[model samples]
Target: MSSVLPMDLLTYWNRYAEAPITVEESRERGFGWTQYDRHGPAEELLGQPETSLELGCGTGDMTAYLARKNVRAVGVDISPVQIEHCRQRWPQDGAEFVCSDVLTYLAGTTQKWDAIFSNWGALWFTDPRAWLEPVRDHLTDNGVLVFSCAPPVEGCYGAQGMYGNGFRGRVLPVQRWAYSPEMWEGVLRNVGFLEVYAKVLEAPEPDNLGTLIVQAWAR
Candidate 1:
């Protein structure tokens, strides 16, 4: 399985994880943005890979979608409840769901994937410095990694902002780290990701900001 998460965070997620079928839904509702905009870019970046993996694949929606398209898809998440829900929801043969810490699972795996992606999962809870290298190492030579992250608001990075209450209109608490698109690009480059690109998509709401969709090819 996975390492223990912060007690409060674990309790919060396990309690509310069933409200929506997928993490993207929760994110869209919490961040005040439409998910369709993000989905298009994600699909385009993903293409059609023979083997794919999703980090922090909450509920396995993305993983199941990939599997339906004939990819050997695997999803890993730290939350056991979420993984259990995912397996129950998508009991297809093409996809596999594992409840494990992303770094721990990546470190132990000898299989390299053609594509790896996440939509607002692990990147939110942990520092990228800890997992980016491991992610790069887990990919095949020509593999691609794609992920989406929300931009930081005025005080989102400060101590007071650590706790996201009423995010996406939910009372549950969430742990998320917001970073600049430039910083994301730099980190991917530093970790040896090639042809790195960050595409910014504005939130449909006139008053809201947008998301950064990043794609990096492994060397």
Candidate 2:
């Protein structure tokens, strides 16, 4: 599979490569501040394993957490800036940071991980089918694919919307795929995931539909 760079999304995230890691500072900057609460830590989701991959890891915060738990954690990101931040911030022996498009990296890698996860990462920006097979191929038997994404919201269709402030005061449009839980389950099943679980949890704030939490196991 050819790796198509999602340049717009990468550029938008680059702006936050140097952003603060604190919840208060992140919330102020409009990043997903509640991600920690939504998905918990890596070990909590997948248990302490021998090896794991944090897909689309922004600043490698969760990647660091996984490494701390004695898992050899590899954090992959499309943005070089974010990967650089990860390397500098964590500097752990077991943690590795790679600057590569997630899809391309997955397709080209021979590594089989015990667990793989993404916390509202670029998985939202690509077709579910595109990555499912690669994930299955790269995950060890019984390994799980866990991720959380913005559940469908009012007027969130297709792959484009107002996302961020661009260079020189311009507004950047977002690109993401926000499908329903049932739709996601079907795709996961069709792509060889043995058991698929999906749920929409209430958002912390009212007036929002909530988040879609998904876990599909490789049997």
Candidate 3:
């Protein structure tokens, strides 16, 4: 099992933001082309939401898209540099980016969101009950939260799973999490979200990793 340090990952993403341009690895790891084929977060916008919050927005590409939709969109990420890139791409006054762990913001802040969504994001929570409840609490009464999560491709639980087989004692962390289909179904119900739409989509690619997508309506 491999353990993940969420804050550390955020700081690493910040370094990418300082680069002259988006790096090749960042482009791949951020997962736009593959995730976009299935989720198309931009296309799903229902038109000018009164307010929107996106968690784990990498490079803030989709957040910028949301801003242009004439919606009040705010993106929260753990990376300061990522926030900087976001600031540069879309200068709309209403589109804001924050530097904080999504869980920390959700737990500490009293703000309620009108609509919440994350793409290729929201899977860092080792304890779903702990992390997800915060997400649910941050949602307004009639609000919606949509995100994509995946279970590990193989046996991975804590440190061993996350780091994979260490080569000569040097550990490399690969993709870290995945959820069983049934596990996801139950989590939403426990969080008081009614099943609106759930689908298993082919991840774009030669690799073609799969995605378990659940978009639920809040009760």
The TM-scores of all predictions, comma-separated, are 0.80, 0.81, 0.73
Q: Looking at model 1, report the run of 10 residues with the lowest lDDT sum.
A: 26-35
Better of 1 and 3 by lDDT: 1
Q: Write the per-residue lDDT of candidate 3 for residues 152-202, one digit (tens) a residue.
A: 456544222343334664343544345555666776787777755555556
Off by over 4 Å in 2: 1-9, 22-42, 154-173, 205-209
Pick the lDDT winner: 2
Candidates 1 and 2 compared by TM-score, better number = 2
Model 2, 1-219: lDDT tens digits are: 223246756777787676747634433333132343433222455755688897888877767766767888898998889988778777744689999988999988799998898877768766765887888899888788888877876555545445466444445666678767887788789878879888886666666457787888878
State how far residue 62 of model 3 sits from its true place (Å).
Answer: 1.3
Candidate 1 structure quality by residue, lDDT tens digits, 95-157: 899988889899888999999888877766766768788888888888889888676664455
Q: Candidate 2 clashing pairs?
A: none
- Displacement of residue 206 (Cα, Å) in model 1 is 3.4
User: What's the lDDT of the predicted structure labeled candidate 3?
Assistant: 0.62
